[model samples]
Target: MQLFYQNLLPEINYLDQDESKHCIKVLRKQQGDELDIIDGKGTFYKAKITDASAKKCRFEIISTTQERKVAFHRHLAIAPTKNMDKMEWLVEKATEMGIDEISFFQSFHSERKVIKIERLEKKAISAMKQSLKAKKPLLNEIIPYKQFLKETDVSNKLIAYVDFKNKIHMKNELSHQQDTLVLIGPEGDFTPEEVSLAIENRYKKVSLGNSRLRTETAALAAVHLMNLAME
Candidate 1:
């Protein structure tokens, strides 16, 4: 089914400006065409087009479907990389792979200082539609590492860091069906003090693998491994 996205639903006979433009101009869809719409909160609606204006396509809801809640809750808390494209790509792939939430942090050695959450939100919505997912992952803005560690709440906490000469793997540490949370460090990796603080706070130290990975790569890797553990 053809899918469209909107953050809020309009009550009257009006379509979202962007959805309308895509329906009328790009798709050239006509009145009475069937389409699917998602509110990005676990519900889907099948609608039939009523008006076909390029600026304002209108549709009537024909049927509705509700998706089940996620079986496993996974959150990836990471330090955004220096390249904006890499971060955006990570957001897209993570959403497509069914991530529950993503948060950015400013670590001791982080190269990026600021984040544009608005753009990231848009990218997430687009990925949701493209992947035909009913729920979109939550995107959080840049936060300080210490503040994030103190304020975030999750049942299972893990830090993906390799000590100077120590080697351990994340796949060996995770348990199934847990509310998993993982911290991925910056390009320079987390400082010894940061790692020590996390350990003191009950965060388990785990490694994705022996090979070194970029910040984004580690984030995505953690996400995939977490989902695998649940399955």
Candidate 2:
């Protein structure tokens, strides 16, 4: 089934602008062609083409369904990088790997600030549809590290850091039953004060592995390990 994204629904007879172009002009789908629509919050509808205008192809819902939630909940918070390509790639991969929520934080040594979330949201929806997943991940607005910490609430809090002077590993520290929040630092890593503050708040220190890793790599590795721990 051809899948399309529309965040709003009860969306009676609305044609997806880009997907409509793809349907009418690219795929050349005509009226009555069967398609599927996702509202990105677990809602899936089976629809048929009603109007096939390249810019405004319309559809009618035939049936609707929702998917079951995952066995474990996850949220990954990372410092946004200076090179946006890496950050964008992280968003895509995290969505494919089944992350529940993503937050971009401006860390002490972070090189970038003021991320544009709309593009990331679009990337996430595209990845979700491509993965054939029924639930879409939440893309949070970028914020400062302190504010992010103040606002987030999770059962387990983990900070991925490599202190040559201090040793810790995520595998040994994370609890399987609790919803987790992992903080992946910037390229330069989190400042000593930031690490101290996080530890003060009960955020455990953990390492993704022994080898040194880039910020994006650490973030993705954290996501992978979290999924594995739940499994």
Candidate 3:
């Protein structure tokens, strides 16, 4: 079943303009038609259209369901790519693979130090609905790499770096069913000094594989490893 995403639902019995357009004009949903909507906070809702104008389709909530959280939660913190399309693709695929949180960091060698958080969020929402996932991953605004490492804390902390010195594979380092945070660096990869700082800040150095991957590819690999460990 196709699902619609709206952060807040049926508060005043309406969908926002974008969703309304899709429901009315695009899908041709009309009054008394039923559809599923997700609030992106773990709830799936059943609603029936009350008014089906192309600009403001209104609905009445018939029922609500709280989706169960997975035993494992995956949080990925990576440097944003210089190309927005790559980053957007990463967000889409990672969400479909079942990630819980995403953060963008600007590393010392980061080619791109900024990102459009709103645009990233929109893609994530679309992915969540397309994947039929009730829980939405939390996407953080871009922040400095060191700052993010210093501030964030979780049970398991890992950094994917290709210095070839650490030799610890991310797949080997992962502990099943636990909250894991993996950091994927920028295009040129994290500087030796930055990697050292991450180690100093309690992040265990790990590697994805011997085959060198792109920024987005490495991030998606880490995310996949995270999900695979749980399975």
Candidate order by TM-score, highest to lowest?
A: 3, 2, 1
- RMSD of each predicted structure: 1.9, 1.7, 1.4
Q: Compare the candidates by TM-score and give the number of the best one.
A: 3
Q: Please, what are the lDDT tens digits per residue for candidate 3 over residues 1-231?
A: 979877876465688899899999889998999989998889899999999988878889999988877887789999888999999999999999989999998888888888998888889999999999888899999999878987999888999886655688899988656789999988888888998898888889898888989999999999999888877
lDDT of 3: 0.88
**Which parts of model 1 have CA positions greater than 4 angstroms off?**
10-13, 164-168
Worst 10 residues of 3 by lDDT: 5-14
Off by over 4 Å in 3: 10-12
Per-residue C-alpha lDDT of model 1 across residues 1-231, encoded as one tens digit per residue: 577876565355556788899888999999999878888877788888898888888888888898667777789998888998898999999998879899999999999989899888989999998988888898988899999999997778999988646666888777667788899998998899999989888898887886778888888888888777866
TM-score of each: 0.92, 0.93, 0.95
Please report how far candidate 1 places residue 163 from its true position, in Å: 2.8
lDDT of each: 0.85, 0.85, 0.88
Best by lDDT: 3
Q: In candidate 1, what residue range of length 10 has the lowest lDDT sum? A: 6-15
lDDT of 1 at 95: 92
lDDT for residue 200 in candidate 3, whole number 0-100: 89
User: 100-190 in candidate 2: lDDT tens per residue?
Assistant: 9999899889999878898898889889999887778898888999988888877799999887676878977665677899999999889
